[model samples]
Target: MAPPTTGRLSALLRRCASAGALSPGAQLHAQALVAWRLPDVTLETDLVLFYCRCGALPHARQVFDTMTPSPSMHAYNVLLAASPPSAALGLLSRLLAAGLRPDRYAIPAALRACAELRDALLGAALHGFAVRLGLFSNVVVSGALLGMYAKAEVLDDAVRVFDEMPEKDTVVWNCMVTGYARAGRAKDALDLFWKAQVEAVNMVRDVRAVPSVLNICAKEGELMKGREIHGRMVRILAFDRDVAVGNALVDMYAKCGRVDGARAVFAGMKERNVVSWSTLISCYGVHGRGQEALRVYKEMVSQGVKPNCVTFTSILSSCSHSGLVTDGQRIFESMSKVYSVEPAADHYACMVDLMGRAGAIEEAVGFIRKMPMEPSASVWGALLSACAMHNNVDVGEIAAYRLFELEEGNASNYVTLCGIYDAAGRSDDVAGLRSRMRELGMVKTPGCSWVDVKGRACAFYQGSVPRYLRRRIVWVLDRLLEDMGGSESEDGHTNIYYDYELIRP
Candidate 1:
C-alpha cells in the first residue's frame, strides 16, 4: 500500500529546489519511491516536479519518459519547460508525432524555451497556437509572449502584446523596461518607468517598488531623473535603505563623472557588496587613476570584501590605461588561486590588454593559445593592438588573420593591419591591404578625443585643424610640437608632446 502523504516529502523537495541541491533531491526522490508502494500519478508528477525545480532537466526527462506512455499534459509541460531550447524543440517535435495535443499550461513554458533558444520561428508558431486557443489573453501566457518578442528584439510585437493586456503588473512593467533599455531606447524606458509609478499608485493599493527599477534609470544615464527617483524613494521610504538601491546610486554617480558623489554615497551605505567596490574602481580606472583604483581595492580586501570578476576586470582596465603591467600580472595570477574565481572571457581579454600594452607581444600570444576556451575577436584584437605597439609585423599579420576569420563583417581589422604595415614601412603590404579594404568598401575613421573644460566638453579629431581656439593655446602647442619633433623623432616617425603641455598649462 502507498504510504500516507505527508509534509516531510513536500518540505524536503521545496528545500532542495530552493537551495539548488540537485544531487540531494535525487537521493530524496529515491527514498520517497522506496517509502511508498504503488505510487499514484500524483506522486510521480511530484517527483518530476522536484527534478524540474532543481534544474536537473535530464533527470526530469528520464522519470517523465519512463512513466506510462499515456502521459499527463502536466508531465509533457514539465519536460517542455525544464528542457532548454534545443531539447525542448526535439521534445515538442516528438510529442506532435505522438499525436498529443498541448495543454494551455504547457504552451507558455514551451514558448519560453523557444525564446531562450532564440528560435523566433518556433516562437511565432507557438503564438499562433495560443491565439487560436484564446489562451493569448491569459496573464502568464501573455507575459511569456512578451518575453519571447523582447528576446527576439521584436519591439513592435512585444508592445502589441503589452497593449492588448487588460491589466498590467510590476513584472510586466519590468519586462518592458528591461527590453527598451536593452534595445538602446533609454528615453522610452524612462517614460515607461514613470507610467508604471503612476499606475502603481492608482490601481494597486499594495503595490511595492523594487530596486531593479532604479537600475533602469541608472542604465539610461539620466542622472537628474535618477536623482529624483532616489528622492522619491527617500520620501516614501521605498527601498531607501535597500542595498541594491544604494549600489545602483553608487554606480550611476560613478558612471556619470560624479565620482565624488559616488564616494559620498558609498561612505553612507550601511553595507557594501563587491558590486559597490567594482563601481568605484571602474570610475577611477576611467578617470585614468590606476593607483587610486588599486588603493580602493586594497581597502576592500582588508575589509574582507572579496573581489569578484567585475572588480578584477575594472582593476585590469586601470592597469592597461596606466601601463601597470607588473601589477596587472600579479592580480591576474592571484585571481584563480587566491580568490578561487574562474576567469571568464572578459578577464582573459584584460590580461591580453595588460601584456599587449606593456610590449609583451609574445607573452600575450601564448596566453591566448593557452586559454581553455576559444579566443574571441576582442581578445585577438587586443593582441593585434599590442603587436602594433611593439611593431611586431609578423604577429600582427597572424592576429589580423584570426580576427578576420572571427568577425568578417567588421572592417576595423583590415584597417588596423594596413596601419601597422604602413607604420612599419611595408609599402607593398600596406598597398595590398588598402586595395583590399577599398574593394570591400571599408574606410578608416580618424581617432578622436574629448576633454571637458569648465562644464563644456570639446572634441579633437586626429588630422583635423582646430578652429576658434585661443591664440595662446595654438602658439604654445605649435612651439611644443616643433621642439619635440626634433628631440623625439627617430628617422621619419614623429612623437609629439601635446600630452605634457596640456597638463602643465
Candidate 2:
C-alpha cells in the first residue's frame, strides 16, 4: 500500500498547507528535492499560496520566481491580492504589463486595491476592463467598484456605474447609501433610501437596509422621519431584533430629546448588547439624569454586560453631572480591575470634572499628575471650570496658564480665568487676561440656549431674547406670588418665617 514518491510529496505539501505548518511545510519542500523530485507547477503554486497565507512573503516570492514556467494568471492574482493594498498596485501593474489577462477573481481585488488607495483613475480603468471582460455582471465586483469610486469621492462616476448595473443587489445599494452619507450628503442619501423603499419593498424590509437609512436620519436630526422608519422596522423585524438597529434607534431618540421613547425601545428588547446599554446611559447623561444613568450602569453590570471605553466615558459624564465623586472614583478604579477596560483621556477628563465639581481641586490636581497620558485641552478646560466654580484663584491660574500653553487661541480659557479673577475682585488681573486674549485673536463663543413653549420655540442668546417673551415671563412670575399666603413684613424685606407659637396667635 506504499504510495508513489511523486504523489506522496504532493499530498504532504497539501497537508502542510492545510494545517498552516509553514516551517514543516518548508522542510518538507526541501525533503521533496531528495526524497521524490521537484514538485509539479501545481504543487509549487500551492506551496507558494501556503507561504503567502502564512505571511512568509519572501519565501513565497522565492518560490514564485523559480516557477518552472512563469506563474499563471491565478498565481499572480493571489500574490497581488495578498500584498498590502498600497503596495499591491505595483504588483498588479507588473502583471498587466506582462500581458497576463486578469480573470474575474482578479478584478474584484484590483478594484478593492483602488478603493484602499483612493485611486479613482486605476479603479475606472479596472471597471472598464471588467466591462470588456463581461465580468461586470457579477454583483460583488460591481459592488467593490462602487465602493472604490465612493471612497475616492468620485460619487458621480460611482453613481453612473451603479445605474449601469442591470442587477443591483442590497450590498450595492448599501454601499452607495453609506458612501453618500460619509461624503456629507445626508439629504441625497435619504432620497436614495426613499427611492429604494419605493422600488424594492423587500429591501425596505431588510434589516441592514434599515440601519443605514436610520443612521443617516440620526445624523441629520430628522426625528419625525426616524420615527416613521422605526415604525416600519417594528412591524417587519418584530420578533427579530438587530443590535445595530436598536442602538441607532436609541441614539436617534436620545439626540432628539425623547429619552423616554429611547428607554422604552431599549427595555422592550429581549437581547441587550453593550452598545445598547451605552446608548441609553449616554442619553441619561445628556438629559441631566445622572442618577438614572448610574443605575443603568449598575444594571448592565448585574446582567454581565462588560463595559468598554465608551461605556466608561458615559459613566464618568453621569458622575460629573450628578456631582457623585465617590461613585465616580469607584467606577474609575473598577474599569481596570473588574472590567479590564483601560482608561483613556476622556475618562480622565470626566474624573477631573467630578472632582472639580465637588470642590476637591487639590485632589483633582493630584489625579491629573498621575494620569497615564498627557492631559488634553478638554481635561484642562474641565479643571478650569471647576476652579472658577470654587473661586480657587491659585489653581485656576495654573490651569489657565497650562491651557494657554496648550492652545494659545482658546477664548474659553481666558474667559474662565477672568471669571475666577473677577470673583476674587482682581480687576486688574481680569483686564490683563482680556487684553492677552484679544492680542491672541481669541474671540469668545456666544452662549445660547433654546426653550420650547406652548408649541413654539425660541432661543435666547447671551445678551438678548425676544422682548415680548421676556415681558411675559416677568408678568407670569409677578402674578404667581401676588396672592401668596403671607403677612407683610414690618421692615423693608418680606418675611415668611414660620413660628409655631405665632401661628396659635
Candidate 3:
C-alpha cells in the first residue's frame, strides 16, 4: 500500500477525534510522525486540537512543546480553550514569554478563562493590555471584556467598557443587556434594550437578545414589556418560527401569572421541541393545573416528541404539587422501563415528595430506602415538610435528623423541625433545637416580597413598605380591597386572603 499523504492523515485524525477514539488517534499521531520529515504547522496544530478535544491535555501539551520551533496562536488557543481557567491563564503567560502577540482568538479565549475563574483583576489587566494594543476597539474583544466583567459580577466595570467602546455592535449590546439581566438590574436591562432598538437603526438587531429580556421581564413580573417584545417578535416573524424564542415567550408568560397567554403562545408555535412542551407543563404545574399538565404531556408524547430528563422533571413536579400520587408513581416507573431514562436524584426527590404529600410518610421513607442512590437533602426535606403538615412527629424527627446531617447550614430545616416539635407539644425538643441553632449561628432568612410598579421593581420587607411608596402602596391595596367588596374595620384594619386557584381559559 502507498504511504498516506498529510491530507489523508489529517482527515483520519479528525474522524478519530470526532468519534472519541483516543487509541486510534494516538496511533495515527504516531504514523504522522514517521510519515512527515519536516513538521507541518497545520498538521501539528490539527493534532494539538485533536488531543485537546479528546481531553488528553498532557498529550496536547507535549505535541505543542515539540513543534519544530514553536506553536502558533491557533495552537495556543486550542490549548487555552480546552484547559481549565488556571491552566489557560498559565498558557497565556507562556504565550507572552514566547514573544507571540496574542490575536483576537487568543485574547477572547484567555478572557473567557478569566471569567470562568472569576478573576476580575486578571480580566481587567487583559482589558488594559488590549487597550494598549488598540485591540479593544475590535467588537469581539470588547464583547469579551464586557462578558468577563459581567461574569465577575462587576457590572460597573462592564458598563464602563460598554460606554467607552468606539462602536457598539449587536453582540456588544446583547452582552450588556444580558449582563444587566443576570445582575438583577431589570430596569437597566430593559432601558438598554429599548435604546438599542431605537438608536441602532442602521445595524441589524440581534434576535438572541430577546430571550434574555423576556427572562428579566418574567422574573420581575413586567408583563407589559414582555408583551411589547412579543409583538416585536411577531412583526419580525420570529414568534412563529424560532423555537427558542417561542420557548422563551411561553416561559415569560407562564411565570408572570398568565397561563392562558403561555398556552396561546404554545399553541401558535409552528415548531415545538422538548423545551416548549416542558415549559408549558411547568406553567400548568405552577398554576396548580395538574390535569392540564398531564394532558399536555400526553399530547407531547402523542406527537412523537420524546421526553428528556427535564420533561420528566416538570411532569413529576406537576404530579407532586397537585397530589397525583398514582400518576407520579406510574410515571416514575415508566421512566426506566418504557423510556429507558433512568431516574436521576431529582426524579427520586419528586417521587418522595409525591408520596409524602399524599399522607404516605412511611411509604415515602420506604421509597427512599429503595432508591438506587442515596437520597438527597431535598428528598428528606420534602418528607419533613409532609410530616409537619400531617403532624407526624415521629417521621418528622427522623427526616429532620437526616436533613441536619446533610444540610447543617440550612436554617430552614432547623426551623421546620422546631415547628413540628412545637406543634406536637414537645417543648424540650424545641428548646434544644433553638439552642443548637443559636450555637451554630444560623439565622432565619428575612421574608420579603416584590411587586413591579410602573416598570420598576419595588421590594418590601416583612410588613414594611418603602417610605417613598407608602401612600401609593396603601391606596393600591385599599382600591383592590374595595373592588373585592371588602371594607375596613372601625379601627381601620383590612384583612387580605389568598387562594391558589388556577385561572381558567
The lDDT values for all models are 0.76, 0.81, 0.87
> Order of all candidates by TM-score, from best down to worst?
3, 2, 1
Worst 10 residues of 3 by lDDT: 496-505
Candidate 1 stretches greater than 4 Å from native: 1-39, 50-63, 66-69, 77-83, 86-103, 201-221, 236-244, 341-352, 355-380, 383-410, 413-433, 445-505
Which ten contiguous residues of candidate 2 have the minimum total lDDT?
A: 496-505
Tens digits of lDDT, candidate 2, 1-505: 4434766666877787778888888887787666646646776777777788778888887887787767767677778778778657877787788888877778888888888889899898998899899988888788888999999999999899889887887778878887888787877788888788778546766667566667776666678778988888788874236778888888888887677778888987877789999999999997777889999999999989899999999989988998888899999999999878888889999999999999999999999999988999889989999999999999999999999899876788888889999999999999988888777788897776554465344766654645566667656555655655354644332333222221121
Per-residue lDDT of model 1, residues 229-336, tens digit only: 767666665433567777787777776656676777778777778888888888878867788888998999999999998999999999888888888889988999
Residue 224's lDDT in candidate 1 = 74
Best by lDDT: 3
Q: What is the model-wide C-alpha lDDT for candidate 3? A: 0.87
lDDT pick, better of 2 and 3: 3
Candidate 3 residues 1-505, lDDT tens each? 7778888888888888788888988888888877762387878888998898899999999889888788888899889888888989999999999998888878888999999889999999999889888899888898899999998999999999999998887788888888999899988999999999987753233587788999998887889999999998998878988888899999999988877799999999999999999999999997788989999999999999989999999999999999999998888889989999998889988888888889999999899898879888988988999998888999998999999899889999999989999999999999999999999999998667677676556875653544556656556655776786475545343434442111111
Best by TM-score: 3
